[model samples]
Target chain A: MAGVRILVGTAKGGFILRGDERREHFTVEGPLFGGWEVFHLAASPVDPERLYASQAGGWFGQIVQRSDDGGRSWNPVDNAFVYDGEVGDHLFYDGTPQPWTFQKVWHLAPSLTDADVVYAGVEDAALFRSDDAGASWGELTGLRQHPSGTQWQPGAGGLCLHTIVQDPTDPGRLTVAISAAGVFVTEDGGASFDPANRGLQSGEIPSEQAEVGHCVHKLAQHPSRPQTLFMQKHWDVMRSDDGGGQWTEISGDLPTDFGFAIDVHAHEPETVYVVPILSDSEHYPPDGALRVYRSRTGGGEWEPLTRGLPQEHCYVNVLRDAMAVDTMDECGVYVGTTGGTVFASRDGGDNWEAVVDHLPRILSVEVQTLP
Target chain B: MIRVTLPAHLRTLARTGREVVVEAAGDPPTIRTVLDALEGAYPVLRGTIRDHTTRQRRAFVRFYACGEDLSQLPPDTPLPDEVVTGREPFAVVGAMAGG
Candidate 1:
């Protein structure tokens, strides 16, 4: 029987939730690496048993752990994230130059082809690649060394490169999103990058549609249609048809588009999902009612999926990496909240149920479908 | 042999108990030699106690020996006789940081 394994990263540690194909009941595994902030946990698409975790805290710095037998056991890998030659300055929030420094790893994107290869997105905003699994890492300096590097400023969460989207069809193409620096695409596999924020707009910056200043919260793409992308920016819900060459606002009929999470249905190319929060200043659901808006026709028309979800007195926020979809026959959608609840919809957002609750503040949720 | 007491987290990470022993290679055992031996014994603790590139002790990680704060001392400074001879254990402490 096929099953789904959900890897959840939380403020206190990491947890694994296992559910059979029916997707009804689940057993929670752990606070693996307890007392640490697990920013993200990712499993390799090529090998369901291979997994990587980004664990860090204030008292102790970053530690990358890799597991070969799924999440049963883990061993610490290399945590050294040294910048390549000549670390330069980037703009701080006050518009002053600050030297690039190494911080915790915010996101890890294992290779879609090779189980031994993985890429890490880290704060202080840089990309790193490990060929021998997670044993060692080297910075893909071209992205940071771009001409617009110095002008990029930190968002409220500090300057971090939190997203790395690999082009499923084209091995050489990859897309990465930073907090306040907008999106950048690499055609030569991390050797060089180009800004792809053509249609993105941000009212906070002096130029609303600058080349590289938009705060892109999260981006989602379906494997079948890699060129089409859906984004939940700091304020607007957006879609791009040309692999991020240009974007258009698809925030029509939504209450408030100020959200952090956006994801695509596993098997549907046009189906998309976004959780709408109140506003930029307020991070909770509108009217304390938790709702997930789904768009069957890509965007511009959306319907709220409220069945089995908390409709009132629910003030939790969904983070950018907290929503994921499993590629099962029925397509399971999972959402983890700041209130430490993992909500699941087994029947494609028609109905939902709490898979697990009261663990820790969830940071990221990723699911792997095992055959 | 030099005895070292690691913080609870470090002990957990190194997969050991509170105290571990290492053989310092310096002529007169110093903080640098002791740390080098510790990291050599447990590779996982390389970047945890100090910066990987700069080798500077982490901001919140302090060192103590013989009831004296040795965190501010230079890494190359020789250790006290009691610490070098294993009469007293060198301690690695995580500073009291508020959540």
Candidate 2:
């Protein structure tokens, strides 16, 4: 009885898509938290039953909720999930005001090996590490206080850490991507970080890009190959070997380099996929065409997989977490759009089908394979 | 009058079988009145559709009248004739999804 659960968060609230893998019949659980924007959705890798979500509003502060029974019911943590120090008071300096109040938790990832080790990325481009699940969180003082933290400009949403990639092979070796901070890696967990965007073009051109501080939209690490990485940068989809120490552009035949979500095959390192859209002024799909392109050889060549989708005039903007690859036997590929549509590709982006439409502005898509 | 079909979740709450008949003169009228009448008859469905105090539709729950999204349509907006004539049932569905 394998159940595939999709955690969908939007500006209003969140819901759960419960589908039996064998039957393919699906049902949604609840609106969950009403009137709150759920941006980050995560399930504990160690315990599939435990689910976590980060909620925020235009004015309300950020909060994290957890579900013990496969997201059927949820409750907020006893103490609010946040950094150790207060929002606007720094003990080091005489009241310098510690930037923002951790506005949004864009990415929530539990440690692949440690059940209690969970990491959260938030506004002001801060990284918080929790060793005891959501019970207590401490700021990664090293990364938060790095000299480069000051220049890490956020994307349209403000400076925030949107993606966190932990090495399954080496639990201590981890990489995180900030919108404008490019990519940073820590060999000894979250103790310290160094800019790993050596060969990456920071921005549009080689000379113009920051080299290390490029505006990185998202990052995808092959589940098996810890050294190989794929990123949707401000300009292109890039590839990096040797654990993000350097990068090279791989967006050869794609319609445009601008996109949000990039997913690497869980078991196959060479196979990766990304949803492309027009960059700069042409921010939607190419000529208003909505298609997900797959590169069999690590973003070398691209092929548009649009079967069972709109052929013409599909101007959709897929968010960073909206497109995900199911790590199952069928290797399902799913992508949700800002237009409130979710498409599923069971054959790993070879074909596509619209499973649900007109729900709301889909902010994030997460696939959790049940045991 | 438009015939309304409640999903299993709502049907269990409404204690009805297949379809629930709502009385309306013209095209099912608007989502507001349809919900008002539905809840008026089945008080349990009142809080489920809209908040008890504000009477606002619950987030992620929308109305579908004749294959059209009636989520943003004002409560007073009139429904289609097919829905009013019982040819089509106005569905108050909870948008099922999670990510």
Candidate 3:
């Protein structure tokens, strides 16, 4: 059958497991948009029946759901983002000087070839574009009017713009990852942007090579080598080859590189993936073991994918868009946990299974490979 | 008509059945003309109960009626005559602070 949907995004709703293509049986369906929070779930490489969700809540805000007969039905569209004129300011993790605020849609990048073109990564960090498929949305504003955006600061998950990386062979390049603001590059398609965070360092700021407060915690590339990027920084495990403009500290032997997702293996452009997490206030998994550190040769030789997961008590924690990969043909690796389990490995991670476990608390994991 | 109730997640995204009668004809009947007439007869409940360019109101939403708390009144105020007729329904609630 060669089908596979996966798409999950949780913390109350949105799930659709479905499976085939030897990834072995699965058929979960959904919490649909129930209770709200769906953070990100995109599918439209040129229209796989078109789908895009970022439904949110805290009492109904940020809604954008489009599915033209794919998720079986959905419409919502247009949740007004407004910001083009006076919405500029950032730096308040006590650095004071606040202002720009709109708080929700944490990620949803659609348009690798336009299913009506999309892209919205909000939460005060800014960047929105909806070429009319999700009804309407504007504001690209040279990425918060770049110029190092008043030294952007606010991570602890507030200043968001969470990972957008799309360079399917440069349709005017793109790479966005902001959380404490770091790594921004839009070679003239997103109107304007710079700070690719040259060789990021950030020893808690005050110029450790500052350009835009480094807190980038995820940025994988590989649509056939989009200039080779791959990061999982909030604490090293980076590598760039001139796309995010110079970075290199592949975090070699990795046991504690502190992480929040980083991926890049669809057919091995040197293969890569990360799930380190043990430091940065210990967010679980180094000794509580749930390993998944592959790297065929992309970032410093790694290897841990631990059989069907869980080694001794398995503490969980695997977020930052919650990892995903599936172009099928024997390469399938999907992960989503904060203890709501989703792990599946068709063959890439070497072996693992569990497509749907608890359900609410995943946040994101996309994949649509139907045929 | 104007009865409105929704909020079990917008009655499951307007698939309906948490009470809804709608038809907020304005002239003095406010709460943004009854949510612009319940999102103009459920146009996907427009930005989910207010906000699609600062029409404001969604901070864990709240809007009651004959029981007042009209979500802090003033979306042009004036609502009560049994929620402006249809004998008080106008709900929309869902607040319970963070986590």
Best by lDDT: 1
lDDT of 1 by residue, A278-316 (tens): 998899999998999999999999999999999999999
Give all TM-scores, in the order shown. Answer: 0.99, 0.74, 0.38
Q: Which of the predicted structures, 1 or 3, would earn the higher DockQ when compared with the native?
A: 1
Q: Highest DockQ: give the candidate number.
A: 1
lDDT of 3 by residue, A249-332 (tens): 887998988889878778988889899999888788888988889989988889888998888987779888988998888789
- Compute the lDDT of residue A98 as modeled in candidate 3: 86
Tens digits of per-residue lDDT for model 2, B47-75: 45665445677675778877898888888
DockQ of 3: 0.30
- Model 2: how far residue A59 lies from native, Å: 3.2
Q: Rate the local accuracy (lDDT) of all candidates.
A: 0.94, 0.75, 0.84
Give the alpha carbon lDDT tens digit for every residue of A1-371 in model 2.
48688888877778788778742667876576666788878888898888888876543245677778878777655224345444432221222334544456888898888777788887767788788778766778666666666545556766778889999898888798887667889888878888888767653434554644577889998777889989998788899888887789999988888888899876677888888888755667887778888888888798898787777888778889887777788788888888877788777877777767776788899888776
True contacts kept of each: 0.46, 0.00, 0.79
Give the number of the best model, judged by TM-score.
1
Q: Candidate 2's error at A130, in angstroms?
A: 1.8
**Model 1 segments more than 4 A misplaced:** none
TM match of model 2 to true structure: 0.74
The DockQ figures for the candidates are: 0.74, 0.02, 0.30
